[model samples]
Target: MLATGLTFVAMNGIVRHLGTGLPAAENAFLRFAFGLPLFLPTLIPALRRGFPRDLWAGFALRGALHCLGVIGWFYAMAHISLAEVTAIGYVNPVLVTIGAALLMGERLSWRRMVAIGVALVGMLIVLRPGLRALGSGHLAQLCAAAMFAASYLIAKRLVERTSPAVAVAMMTATVTLALAPIAAAVWVPPEPWHYRWLLLAAGMGSLGHYFMARAFAVAPMTVTQPVTFLQLIWASLLGTIVFGDQVDLFVILGGGLMIGAVSYITWREAARRSPITPPIDVAKGA
Candidate 1:
């Protein structure tokens, strides 16, 4: 989990470094496109076996939603401070809980409701509407979180019918295909240096996902989920030291609240032996 947090933060730092030189769609396309090669080993076998035809629509839908989320995340990286983006993203697990109840028919207990409410309050603290202006970047992150949550709910269903590798490979391929035309429509010729950084970002993103999966496999979500809070701390420090972004106390406090709420939800689900809400790693869109 620590490695997962570090690699993801490093990937975000690279995206922040890239800024808005390329369109967000193009940037998102290139990141996934470059990462696609890393999955070829898994993709080849999965292709040879052939995918279950019934699951194609699910994969396509998930790809489209995740593609949009990636575009929004890239745009947010360019527009907002890393700390703000990271803090806002902590709301994803909460969003996933709501999505699971609405779309998957999961029961919403009173305790879960309270946790969700706390998460909403935490989110409002970070955004602080009325007290301060909300920018497009802030709105984009919130939308991205919803898209990511929806994608995750779909993934839970798909995973029941297929292997994790096949699911992941198909998602990467579908998202790459989905992003291509959008990238081309708004394409800007990237500098040679952009390719180098984006490739590195792709590598780090893949590594982060791999580490997160491993962490989940070895430890319970209840144990692993809380450790992810370190990511906000890392993001805050990195934003301040490297990018000169101001360290907002409200962002930190709110993020902590959200993380606490998420951790409680995970513990409850684990204790009940119900369908555990997917971890916030979906925020990384593995």
Candidate 2:
């Protein structure tokens, strides 16, 4: 999860440094296009080994959810501070936790609720709804976070029945296909340097997802999730010192609260997950 955060931050930094002149759709397409080669080997095995057809519809739905998230995430990152984007967006884990309990009948204990409550406090610190002005970037971040949570939950169920590598490959390919026409129609001329960054974003995203897959293989969502909140700390530091982004008291306090809440929720979930291994296979190995 920490690795995923850094990769995402780096992807954002690369995209932002590339400037807003780049078309969002085109840039997004290019990233996944570049990612294709890296994923080819993983794809081979998954293709030969298929999931039940019944699961494909779920995969498509989840892919669409994730596609929306990727687009919003790119749009927000290109326009906002990397730290701000990262901080706001990383709350999906908490959302997933709540959603799972309600939807999946996953066991929920008081400890998880307390952890979630504390995390909400942290989010409020960053958002500071009553204290400050809100921007479109904030709105984009919120949407992206929610969509990401929905996508991951879908993926979680899908992973239980399919290979993680296959699930990721399908998402990338589907998103690329979905975005292609839109990107081509609105395409702007990109310099060689622009292409370089686009390619880098693709690599980071694919690698990030790969690491995430591996992490999930080793641990349950509850066990592995808290570590992901660490992304906020990376974002704050990266945004301030590296990007020279100005800091506000509310963001600091709110972000910390959010992290604390998320962390607590994760820790409790980890404790309560029962056995480390699934009575059956916990993961389809990467």
For all predicted structures, in order, the TM-scores are: 0.85, 0.89
- The list of candidate 2 runs beyond 4 A from truth reads 48-51, 265-283
What lDDT is reached at residue 129 by model 1?
Answer: 95
lDDT by residue (tens digit), candidate 2, 72-105 = 7778777778767867875788888788778877
Best by TM-score: 2
Clashes of each: 0, 6
Q: State the displacement of the C-alpha of residue 120, model 1, in Å, after optimal TM-score superposition.
A: 1.0
lDDT of each: 0.81, 0.75
Compose the digit string of candidate 1's lDDT tens values, residues 6-52: 99899999999999889999999999999889989978887787766
The worst-scoring run of ten residues by lDDT in candidate 1 lies at 277-286
